[model samples]
Target: MQCTDHTVSLDTWKNIQSLGIQCKRTTYRGVRAGWRKQVKKHTNASPPGNVSLNPPSPSVNLGVINAQSVGSKSAILVDSILDHKFDLVAITETWLKPDDSTADFTPDGYTFTHIPRVSKRGGGHVTEPTHYLGRMLDLVISREGESILAHTKVKERFSDHFVLACKLNMNRPPTLKKIITTRHLKAINITDFCSDFCSSAFSTNLSEITDMSHLVDQYNKSLTDIFNMHAPAKTRTVIIRPFSPWYNDEIREAKHKRRQLEKKWRRSKLEIDRQLYSEQRHFVIGLMCNAKINFYSALINESANDQKQMFKTFDKLLHRSKDSPLPKSSSDEALANRFSDYFIKKIKTIRDLFPPTVTSTCIDVSTNICLDHFTLTTEDEVRKIIMNSPSKSCSLDPVPTWIVKEGIDIFLPALTHLINTSLQSGSVPAVLKEAHVRPLLKKSGLDQDDLKNYRPVSNLPWISKLIERVVSARISDFQERNQLQECYQSAYKKRHSVETALLRVQSDILSALNSGDICALIF
Candidate 1:
C-alpha cells in the first residue's frame, strides 16, 4: 500500500524491454519444415450486409478481446490472455508448426484449428526447400464447450494474403420473422345475428343431467328405521372437564426446562478460537523485511563492478586535478554528479523491483467461462487486485463468443490448479515453470543466480510449526496436540470464513461458537 521509491518504473520498463522476447507476426504461404497446419474451413457463405462471416460482436459483449497473431506463437498469446481475464482473443497470421501431427486444440480450456498450409517441394520463391505443404491460418476459440459453426480463410482480392474467419455455434438466442397472408371469414345473416345465434352456437349445453335424490332419501329412511329398531330403552350421556391451569403451567415449565438444556448443550460445544493474528502480522513484517534485504544485497552485488569503476574514475579525477592546465570546467563536475546520480538511481531501481503487485482478474469469456489473470508485483501482491488496479487496466473487446465459452472450460481448471499450487507452495507451477516464470525473468535480463538466491521467504510459519508440533506430539503421545490442532482449526475458520454460500452456512454455527458469541434462546 505504501512505496518509498516509485521511479524504479523507468528501470523496470527498460529491463522488460531488453529481456522479454516479442512474438513476431508471420504469414507463410506454405508449411515450414517444423510446423503443422490443421484446416478449419467455413461452410456458410458470406452473409448479406457488412456482417462478418466470423461475427465478433456477440463474443465482444461477453468480454472477449479481439487479437491477431501468427502461428503457435498465437497459442502462447492465448496462454497469456488466459492468464489474464479476457473474455475472448483472436489471432491472425498463424503458422502452425509443420511437423506437429497432434490436434490443434490448446490444452487450457481452449480449442483451435490450424488451417493447413501446403507448399510446393521445389526451391522456388513460393515453397520452402524441405516442406511441400502449403500454409494456413487457424481460428483459436474458447466457447465454453461449444463447437465452431464455421471457420474459413479467404484470399483477399486475388492477393496471396488470406483473411481467416471463424463462427462459433454457441447456441445464442434466436430471432423472429413475420409472414402476412389473406384468409376468408364465414358470412352471417342479419336475422340470425339479431337473435344472438353466434353466442348460442358456442354456448355450453346442460341438457344431460340425471336425478339421484330419490335413492338418497330411501337410504336415509331405511338407516333411521334400523337405528330405531336397535335402540335401547334408556341412554346415558357423560362429559369430562379439562385439566387445571396449574397442571398446564407444569407442562409448560417442563418444556421450557427441556429447551434450556438444549441451549446449554449448544453453548458447551462452542469452544474458544485461538489464532495468533498478532503473530501473523509479525510474520508478514518479517517476510517483507527479509525480502527487501535479500533484494538489496543482490542489487549491491550486481553494482559492485560499477562501484569499482567509480572509484577508478575518482582516482583519475584526483590525479588530473593537480596538473590540469585549465581547471576542469563546471561541466565536468555536473557530468560527474550526473553519473553518480545515475548509478545510485540504479540501486534504488533494483530495490524498487523487489516488491511487485500481485492480483488476479477474471475476464468473462462467456456466460459460463472466465479467464483469471494473475499479476504479481511486490507492493500490490497482498491485496485483492481486481481488473481496475491502478497499475493495470483492461477493456472488453470483440472476441468470438465461441472462444470465450470454449476457452475456460478447457483452460480454467489447469490455471486454477496452478494458482492454488503457487499459493500453497509459494513456488511457480511445474508445467508452466519454464515457460511462464523463467522466460519472464530471463526477458528482464536479470541474473538467474541472483534471482534464485533472492527468493522471498515463504510466509507459512504455521506449516513448519505444525509439522514440528505433530512430530513432537507423536513421540510424546500428547493428546493436547489434538486439542491444539482443533483450536487452531477453529481459529482458522473464524479468521477465514468460506466465501461460498453452502460452506459458509455449515461453518457459521461452529464459527460463532468458536468466537464465543453463541447466545441461548429458550421459550
Candidate 2:
C-alpha cells in the first residue's frame, strides 16, 4: 500500500481495515494530515452507544497562532487571548530578533519565550492558515493519552494565521491576594477636630503643671487620642496592581464616566451609544496623558536646582522604582530591637574611641564677656517663634504645628509658662529630649537589610522645636553683643552661609591677584 498527497486507494484502505489498523485524515484549506494506527479490540468492552473510552477531568484552555511579524499587534493578540480566556499560548514565526525582548510582546498575566532565526532573516518555521493563503502551517500538538476536548479555528486574524484554540485536561492556578492598611484622613472635619481638641483635658490646668516631663506626656496622649477619634485606622484586602503616580481626581472621574458610557453602549447595542462611549474612552486617555506630562514636568522643574532630587525624578520617569523590602525577622518588635541594639552599639563604640582623660593647659582669657544664663521668654516671644516656624509636624507632636499656630492665642499662655519654668530650672524636659527615630536608607543602591547602610532620622515634637528656636535666638543675641563668635565663621551664624563664604574667598583671591601675592586654596 502507498499513500499519495495524504490519500490512498480504496483497496489499500480495505486492506488496512482488515489488518486491524485505523486511519484518519484532517484537512484545512490546502493543508492535509493522514494518521495510521494499530487498533486493539477488547472483548469485554461496553456497548459503543452507552459507554466512553476516557473520562473527562478539569482542563486548561490553550491557543496557538502564527504571527508573521507581531510588531505593533501585541495588544490585539493579548486582548483576543483574554477574551477567549486562554491559560497558555504558543506562537510561530514571531519574527522577533535577538535584540527584541520577550517582555515587550508578553502581557501582564502571561510570559513568553522566543527562539528567533539567528543565522539568517526570514528562516523561522511558520504555522495554522497562519498564511494569507489558507494553509495549516502552524500546529498544536499534545502528548499521547493527553485529552483535548475541543479544537476550534478562530475567524479573527492576528497575522497571516488564524487562531487555533484548544481545551486540555489541566487546572489553572488561583490568583494571589494581598492585604494593606489605610488611614481615612479625608473623612475628618477640621472644625470639629479643633473644637474637640480645645475641650479635651489637654489644657485643663496650663499654668498648674510644674513638671515639664508630665506636661509633655499629657500633650502627646491628648493629641494622639484626638487624631484617632477623628480618623480611625482601617485594614483592607487588595490586589497588587501597577501603580500610576500621576493618576488624579480628574482622570479618575473621566474613567468612571467612560465606564458608564461603555456599559450603556453594551446594554443598548446602539451605534450612537457606541460612538459616544468611544469618544469618552479617547477623552479619558488624553486626560491621563496630559496629567502624566504635567506631573513629571512639575517634578523636573521643582528639582532643577537640586542634583540629588533631579536624579530621583529621572529614576521615577525611567520606571526604576526600587523600594527595598524590610528585612526578615521574628517579629516587628524583634526587628525594632535589633535596630536599636545595632545603633546603640555603634554609638558606644565611637564614644569609647576618645581618651578617658585629657591633660588640661590654662590659657590667659582674651575677653571678659560670658553668657551665664538664658533670659526668660515672654508669651509674646513664644507666640512670635511659633508663628515664624515652619508648619511641619511629626507623629510625636500632640497636634500639628499648623494647628497650634492657628490657635496660638489659646495655647500661648500655657506654652510660655512651660518654657519659662524649664528655662529657670536650667534643664531640658526629659519628654522634650525624647524623639521618634526612623531608620532611613543612607543612599540609593545600598543593601537596605544591613544596619550600617541606614541612618537614624529623629523627629522632635513641635513644642520642643519651639523652645529650641527661642534658645537659639537668645544665644545668637549674646554672641553678637560680645563678638564671641569667630569673624571668619560663616556657618550657623545670622547672615552667613555657603554663598557668603564663597564670596569672601573670591574677594580675597581678587585682592591677592591685584597685589601680586600668591594665594593658596585648599578644599
How high is the CA lDDT of each candidate model? Answer: 0.32, 0.66
Model 1: runs farther than 4 Å from truth?
Answer: 1-47, 50-76, 79-108, 112-523
| Model 2 vs truth, CA RMSD | 13.6
| Model 1, TM vs. native | 0.16
- Clash tally for model 1: 57
TM-scores, in order shown?
Answer: 0.16, 0.61
Across 1-523, the per-residue lDDT of candidate 2 in tens digits comes to: 5523444555564576579763433334422111000010111122222212342446566676776676655544554566567677767767777777555346554667666777854225543334334344554443334344333333334555556665555576665567775667667777777677678776776667777777767767876888778877678997543345666788768767866875554444344444566677667656766776798999999999989889999986664545544557888899889889999999999999989997878666777777788899998888878877678887767566766776677667778887887787777777777788788777887887888988887888777888888899999899888777789999999899999999999999999999999999999
The parts of candidate 2 lying over 4 Å away from their true place are: 1-183, 235-240, 248-285, 297-326, 361-366
- Give lDDT for model 1: 0.32
| Cα lDDT tens digits for candidate 1, 1-523 | 3323223343453464478642222334443212222233222223322223456434331212222223323232332333333333333323434565323224333345444446721111121011111343223333333434333322111012222333443543333333332212123223333233113321112122112232223222332333233331233333222111112333345434434433332222211100122233234334434443454456556657787645654453232222212213367566445444554576689989875875758564444322233232221222222112222111111111222222333323222332333433444322221111111222233453332222221122111222233234343333343332344233333245435444646577677788999745343
